[model samples]
Target chain A: MGAGHAHTLHHVGDSPVHRLPAHVKIVAAFLMVIAVVATPREAFWVFGAHLALLVGIWVTARIPVAAIAARSLIEAPFVALAVLLPFFATGPRTEFLGLSLSVDGLLAGWNILVKGTLGVLISVTLGMTTPVRDLLAGLARLRVPGMVTTIATLMVRYLEVIAAEARRMRLARVARGHDPRFLWQIGPTVRGVGTLFLRSYERGERVHLAMLARGYTGSMPLLGVPTTGRRTWAVALAPAAAAVLFATAGYA
Target chain B: MTPSLEVEGLAFAYPDGHQALFGVDLRIEQGERVALLGPNGAGKTTLVLHLNGVHRAGAGTVRVGGLEVAKPHLQEIRRRVGVVFQDPDDQLFMPTVGDDVAFGPANFGVTEPELSLRVKQALGAVGMGEHADRSPMHLSGGQRRRVALATVLACDPEILVLDEPSSNLDPVARRELAEVLLGLDRTMLMVTHDLPYALQLCPRSVVIDEGVVVADGPTRDLLADPAFLAAHRLELPFGFSV
Candidate 1:
């Protein structure tokens, strides 16, 4: 009955961004990412503007810069890919600090770097401001297919339970002298996974029955449908709308 | 007035040819609290499932509030008969305790205003009104169990069927739950292996063994019969008496 351990990505706070309807925020985040993706890599100022917009959101949401940076490290692998692009791409050469580099490769690398970073940064902001359940409800409100939302909702609900079960099973195995460091112990570990899967499957069946016992028919009822008033859309989509303007101006 | 629950000639067998319940008959009056005592694999769960049509019996009839348990009546039957499964994780599958409590009623077309009110009332009944917005995963085991019960109670069921309600609860939680159950006015069928719990909460006890009702009497008398308890593979705590 205490305050739950909030997910690390979602810092609990009240702000205009956090107060916006989840569906509006979801749509705005989507549109902003699309705008960033469509912008030409050569439009360096537009990329800067987009970054500035995300930073504005972070500031408004009261999320710490260090927190955002730490969470954004999820893109490290993509960053590595972007870094490799200049070395591997074949194109017209250019001199940079007395070292030969491809002009086309540099542009491509910049494209990957700016666009991917913006995409991840936008997601981080969204995750930071909205809880997972609200995000799911937002998806439902956005008219995402019921099947997908239901699967996702169930997955989110049971993930911790299954993880806890796995942990308990591991402890039981360890108590019985099973050492995972040895190569031969892999067999038991794999079998344990299979057993966990079977248990999860059975639990799903039981849960389905429980759902039925509570009058669950085919469709899961929508508890609270989010309403995005015109004002909310205008306010929430201001940055995204600006991105579209920037892209168009760059194209013109 | 109709009986809260009536089961006659209820029989069931698994697909693997393992007969779980064979011609089990039981009845409970309105607002009665009955404890169903049984050993493992004694068909207690199977009989419980039949109450709400989760598992259809091959032969027999089940009636809740005068409504027969059948295809067309399933919705009404389920609404009137709320089942709290053995595992709270299975029952409270929604993200938040509030959402889970509102799930059943919402499914039955209970809209907001009333929906939120029902959720609040149910959570209040279980003494979990403060944890409405919290994730079920983050709750203690006892809290989760209470939330699971709230999920069913929100539907305003006339009959509450609980399977192993006290299995994993610590002593404090168990006593708290017993108090909560005692306070509720709805008819309750508590299936459990806890003899002391049964005596404490249910005045009458029914023992099911090997798909049959071996004994039906007062809980204290049933627990006192060592031969009957031994025959059904049930035991009370050491030095504990009714």
Candidate 2:
């Protein structure tokens, strides 16, 4: 059940968290993120508890902490924005390291940094535990429009195919002595991307045709797990339930 | 019983005024394995599309299992006629192998028990029962082809049309696919450029050129005529014989 193509971040294992149905995990993750966002930013301990919750899941799911840390670097650009907030944000100023910084700006920066990190962490944990197909299924079960899940499913399926085509096109250009290292040689690269887009569009057409040939009249059939039971939901949502408790305590 | 596939006076032209097929007439009885030999733009795919209603017939008629290939019978026709496209990647678009195989049946409104049974039976037919949990992306070209065939088979189609099935396969994969195809006792129309594959798998061969069926004869007799093959722009591999 773990074959989600090679591009997914799913850590294939037999952990209880992994065993839980995808929709339940999706709900749990959603609730966890909502709790994180709802908690007051000043409740720094609640944020710590959120991180601890994620760390526990990672440990149980057998995902490497180093890998999650590395993946979380995708938010580094946001960190840059957060770093600048203290300098330009208009609020009461405090002196730190001989430089005047806004106290509210510091708090705002922490809000973005912490919330964004926790959000991304929650997503990574979900991604690592649930296969891509299951994630889409979870979304489907949550009544998130079928059209969105269908698009997501196809994206997961064809991501590598299109990437491989791009690689092949690059190789063909390189074989023809097109040097991409120079600034002036960007024309063909841009055109190649354009060509790749067209090719992908045409591929989409062919895939639709193939789907139709198999009697796909209009909507895609619900191909996900038929039912995710109440027991599974209660079992899976425990972490989010813990986060909710932490959030209420934080409010208190 | 009616012929498995019957296309009479079939014709098609693209929206750009490009004439792809012109009044093509063909019929294949039940259980016949016919190889469609054609050049790059000889309307083989266009004809196949007409078989399953992907392309509405521009001129004439197409019937599958005695049912007209029109709006009324499209759903049923698609169930009866399965086209395994040349590219397996284009065919198997689901996240997992089982899901891809199940896609067609589920679309056909086949519910559980029957749906899962078809998936298992189809995968078993292609000798890929073990890899149902794997991603089609991770499979070898041949394995992917087999799974693609399974996706079609899971629909319980009466006729299978394959487009360039042997393309991009190593010799071993090619032969293995041939074995699988040989074991399936259903009507098949294989569109291919491989003369040797035609000679090996199909007893009868149909040659289409310039939007028409130019020749329809025994595979051995057709491949034996070098001049005829050369005239159709089909060249047998050197030193290969029927």
Candidate 3:
């Protein structure tokens, strides 16, 4: 799980999407989501147009459609909630395939589907383009609490180690003839989770001591010599502005 | 010059009923490289943890660079003593190699430009300057260890407390690590089971067994004493007795 998740989320590339400052991408994505959410449910054409814009961005960013689709499907279960809404909502009923469907339900379904799809697309795009470090940097730049970033940085770094430890424990259990298939076996699985938490907590303490030994005063030092020049800021803001404008029009 | 580390009657026990260390005493002079030899559960790690007050001195004093180990002076003591854990995974807890190295310096409040320079210098020392942007998870075990060293090196601590510096490393990588350690000029206290590595890298050897310091002398003499090693649950690898 660690290897696979780490591999999928982080890819090094020199594309424009990759080069843009993380803060810009985050703000742009948030705005795009807000735009999609605020758009009227009756505006199906606008949703179609927004989806096309996202697709264009993905194509230009050189991200594989299959990867995006696969990620999209991971969220499909939540999307199913919206898929079912059309059957229960109240409004003028319309006959479709000899079954009555409420107009309000149909609109509600469209609203959820469009907003959720756009939100997921924006997030997936950001994840595909930005490395986790830059994402944290972007958050830091945007005034995220230092403690939060520190925790996140530590979490991402040790996530693989923790996952590997979990895998080893699972393998050990399997070797001991413990198959976690039945409900009764779930108690042991939950205990395994508790053990993982304890191990992680202990590891965190040790790591903290190690950090203190290395002269860690409090704040994490910034690297890469950030140059907040007008050009860099301009480069970051251009796409964001364009995204906001497009989303605003869709809302209007 | 004052000793880089001076521990007298050091002892520690977990909050639970289990005791991990008994009375221990040791002294390592400045610029001296010493290897702490022990088996698993030999309290080598517990001793290392005391150098920077990580484990806290249960009943003794731990003085690093003339400062006593106490709550008020912890930050200053920590600044002087850098520790690298056995697991690189624990030490390098940042996304990119550069960021991980920069973490220590950043925590110490080094200015941005200086922090960048420190990061470059540390990574360069480990021959990993090119990997600064790369994620640590993608690196090999040896590379991860090197990066781990760089992370601590970035802080520029006067004393380095390394736990198992050569474990799980291939021969070439171990040789590379040895070369790197030899090149470093700081006072080093390395904990390891690798006898040859201890002999090659450190002039002094300190043996801890069952949480007590059993032997402390020149590496050659300690390794030469077969009975002393046997008494401490340590033995020369195979037929290669020292």
Candidate 4:
């Protein structure tokens, strides 16, 4: 949302993928994930096709391969879960390298690793191409629940302000000779959080009053009516449709 | 022609038994920019809130364009009275400057063509015509303040009530904002502790303290009264003259 500054996840570019409407991208990303999820775990080559499709998008969008790899580390916890499955999952056993491994467990592990990684990669690519503000706008255009979208929009707007306030309060606390690191010394830190909450709540009431002053009765009004047309959807959803075809064709 | 605003015996008390305004009365003509000067807790904000129906009239009546600010006319009253809040953060809550400015008019059912025109005209008035798509948070504090003003301006209200418009502004930003406020033609009721700002922007001034209008006169005469200022904790900056 920066005045000409692109967000970290969103690379500034005029690529065909980037120029596509945000709602179209949102729908496309969602369908890609759905196709990944719906694909059979045994279709290993189809999973490979999915990865190639995403990588093609990455190249077209001009996002660095390393950046995608780095950002995808957010799925490391799931990776850990996948790795542990073969050891902990109770199923039919098989011998491999002098260790009895559960065959079903190994298959389950591969399932999670491949499907989860593909899902996360598609999401990461989506994040890399679209600004967070536009993402929320797309959600609204897709007829997401009003309350959910409203709360999300506000939260995105205020997150930085609240973070900066927290930083200043922390500095002031330090200046006043308070160390919050010690377990026994967390009282002041906790109190600071409470103070921040109260301040934020009071600010919300003031903002609500400000909104009321400007003729806000109950619902929020739409600022931009998304004009994403049929052609844009057809073009944007092509890759997702291809992925779906790959999943359905049993390409493995 | 009717006065732009009329408030008579407007009284309000909090649920905790703290009375903020007790029988406050004021009148503003169609094009007068009046400074509502007061000490802290003097109910300046309370009175301004009543103008827009943010706070209901507990006792007396408030009318804008001869329309009472009662339940029946709340919407019309709000549409006619645009309040610029103290913190720009509170006012500019939308994603973009254009969106924020358009919020007020769109709520009153102003359709697209006119809405965009209003947004453009308002932003142009504030010298922010090119910032229609920019996020308010990305702009400098002064720019954000101007955008906040544009948000109210898009509504084209009969009266503009500003709360501490110059509170957090630097010297340059304050002067720039003062220039903008001085150029506007609407009736303005500005609540501020900035004495010099009151002198620069408003010709008429009213001092309200302890829930009452203590003094009402020309801005220069009121600021020059040392005893009157001291009684209300209103202090002009050092070496500053009227």
Docking class of 3: medium
lDDT ranking from best candidate downward: 2, 1, 4, 3
The whole-model lDDT of each prediction reads 0.89, 0.90, 0.81, 0.87
User: Compared with the true structure, what per-residue lDDT tens digits does model 2 show for residues B158-234?
Assistant: 89999999999999999999999999999999999998999889999999999999999999999889899889899
Deviation from native of the Cα of residue B217 in model 1, angstroms: 2.3
Best by lDDT: 2
Question: Interface Cα RMSD per model, in Å?
Answer: 1.8, 1.3, 3.1, 1.2
Backbone clashes in model 4, listed as residue pairs: none
Model 2, A50: alpha-carbon shift in Å? 3.0
Compose the digit string of candidate 1's lDDT tens values, residues A1-252.
Answer: 212443667867799998898889999999999999999888889988898888899889998998889989999998898888777789888887897888888889889999999999999899888888888888988899888888888998898899899999999999999887878769988999999999999999999998898898866788876556799899999999998888777676
Question: Candidate 1's residue-wise lDDT over B78-189, tens digit each?
Answer: 9999999889999988888898898899888899889999999999999999999888888888998889999999999989999889999999999999999999988999
| Candidate ordering by DockQ (highest first) | 2, 4, 1, 3
Query: Candidate 2, residue B43: CA error in Å?
Result: 1.7
How close is every model to the real structure, measured as TM-score? Answer: 0.96, 0.94, 0.86, 0.94
Error of 2 at B15 (Å): 2.4
| CAPRI category for model 2 | medium
Model 1: runs farther than 4 Å from truth? A1-6
- Winning model by DockQ: 2
Chain A TM-score, cand. 2: 0.92
